[model samples]
Target chain A: MKALEQKILTDGIVLSDTILKVDTFLNHQMDPLLMKQIGEEFAARFQHKEITKVLTIESSGIAPAIMAALQLEVPMIFARKRKSLTLQDGLLTSNVYSFTKQEETEISVAKKFLTEDDHILIIDDFLANGQAALGLLHIVEQAGATAAGIGIVIEKAFQDGGERLRERGIQVESLARIESLQDGKVQFVKETRRVEV
Target chain B: MKALEQKILTDGIVLSDTILKVDTFLNHQMDPLLMKQIGEEFAARFQHKEITKVLTIESSGIAPAIMAALQLEVPMIFARKRKSLTLQDGLLTSNVYSFTKQEETEISVAKKFLTEDDHILIIDDFLANGQAALGLLHIVEQAGATAAGIGIVIEKAFQDGGERLRERGIQVESLARIESLQDGKVQFVKETRRVEV
Candidate 1:
């Protein structure tokens, strides 16, 4: 988390008070070194739980989810986002509203992937509105699977998504929680200790 | 490769003559252990090359790219597919036509992530028409970077993607090459030897 926060300070570009673009190292372009470490952190955090699988959304979330799945020694299932929903046979689908994109998208997973016997750990790159996570949760619930906890790389604490999930008594752990991004500067909810380069 | 071939034989579903869905393991619900092996195989194949980075497209390509990057000990960059083209100053963008989806999507990477000195190895889940790889190759060319080679998990030999890349003198290594999928039965280009289960 210290490395992540420091990387955010050095490489993360704050485009606005509400937008932080980590395309340099997090989302579009990823640092596998940091991603592997992030996965280890999640594995350590949920070491006590019975995590049968790691669930995430497509595109951005797959990076960290793959790393976490490697550390946890579990398979990962990513729900694919569809522009339009059609059939209802083998797919377990849910509709999610993206606050950043300001659009609604449908996400789905094959019903065969999840079952009542599985315990899932949800992982994502950013948790601003928590819509993606909630959608994944819906898929997990539809399969009668249990969600052990949620692991997020960065959480916009200023947003109500993380708080909303916590209010529901869902265990959520974000590696780095941003209190705000005002004045084109990122402020974390908890200050990080000085780290050696 | 044998393991991968065996996996394909067991889990891969032939949705049609042209479409073989491995979402149960390769894409949607991923098997990390198999993916790790696939990555190791990619590393072994390209071990002689100086691969500074691993390049891939977003969504399905992220999983194998992550594994190959982890095995190669390099950074991985996934070109995000955007429905629209925005500012192109800080990005290297290309338009790719998806034969499956029958649409044109814009894919881009931050200009800073790729450089002239970088040697990139392209990784993807499936090579159908090779449009995605070609788009990525264009990005590498735009960056003045050299493509070391390409590593594909599965190749639809019936399609011209692999043949096209080879015709262009691009090095391509596919884990499993399918001869055809007739009558819902999959056949490999090269017969795999008997393996220990």
Candidate 2:
């Protein structure tokens, strides 16, 4: 978590007051070594949970999710942002709102992957509005599976996504929690609260 | 590679004569253990190349790319299907025609990641029409980087993508090469030809 926070401060670009882009390390251009460490961190946090599968959205979340799946020794399922030609008809679909894009998109997962017996852990790169997490949770619910927990690499604490999900009693664990990113300076939540999750 | 072929034969759903769905393990619902093996195979194949970075397109390609990067101990970069809110303005963009989606989408990568000094090896989930590979090659060219090789998980030999890229003098190593899928009976190109490339 410290490595991630420090990397964010060093390599991450703050395009605007609200947007913290860690694409250099986490998303667009991925540091696989760092990713493995981050994944291990998530695995360590959710060590007690009996995770049958890890769920995520396509694109950015795939790397961390895959890494976490590696550490957790579980299979990972990424929800397709759009239905492709290869994907079949029977799917668990949910509408997710992207705060950055300000548009709602229907994300779907193949129904065969998730089942009632599965204990699913939702993972993603960024947790801004929690819309994507909610969508994944919806798909997990649709499959009648248990939502064991949610693991996020970076969560904007100033945003209500983390708070709202926590208030909902969902066990959300994030490696880097951004307290504020105002006036081009990034601020993080104190490290003392890292173990409370 | 044999394991990948075996997985395809066992879990792959042949939707039609031309379409082979490998979402069960290779893409959608990814088996991390298998992915790691596939990644190691790629790394072993490209062991000679001094690859500074690994590249791929987002969504389905991210997992294999990440795995290969892990094996190679290098950073991986995924070209965005659409420029997200986090991505910047100075991007290397390419127009890729998706046969699956039946549409042309602009894929972009951050210019900062790819450089003239870098040696790039492109990784992808599938090599069908070679449009995505061509697009990625174009980005590498734009960066003035050396395209060391291409590593594909599955190459449909029936399609022109693999042939075209190989004809262009690019090194392409595919784990599984399907020669024919006529009448739902999958036929390989023969395992003897695996070592030629």
TM-score (all chains, Cα) for each model? 0.92, 0.97
Tens-digit per-residue lDDT, A14-107, candidate 2: 8787798887888789999898898898898888999989999988899889889999999999999988877758999999999888789999
Best by DockQ: 2
lDDT by residue for model 1 (A25-72), tens: 788778888888988888888878889999999888888888889889
Candidate 1 Cα misplacement greater than 4 A, ranges? A83-88, A191-197, B83-89, B191-197
Model 2: lDDT to the true structure: 0.89
On TM-score, the candidate that comes out on top is 2
Tens digits of per-residue lDDT, candidate 2, B1-197, equal 78888889999878787889888887799998898898898898898999999999988788888889998999999999887765658999999998888999999999989999999999999988999999999999999999999999999989999988998877899989999988897788887345544
Candidate 2 docking quality: incorrect, acceptable, medium or high: high
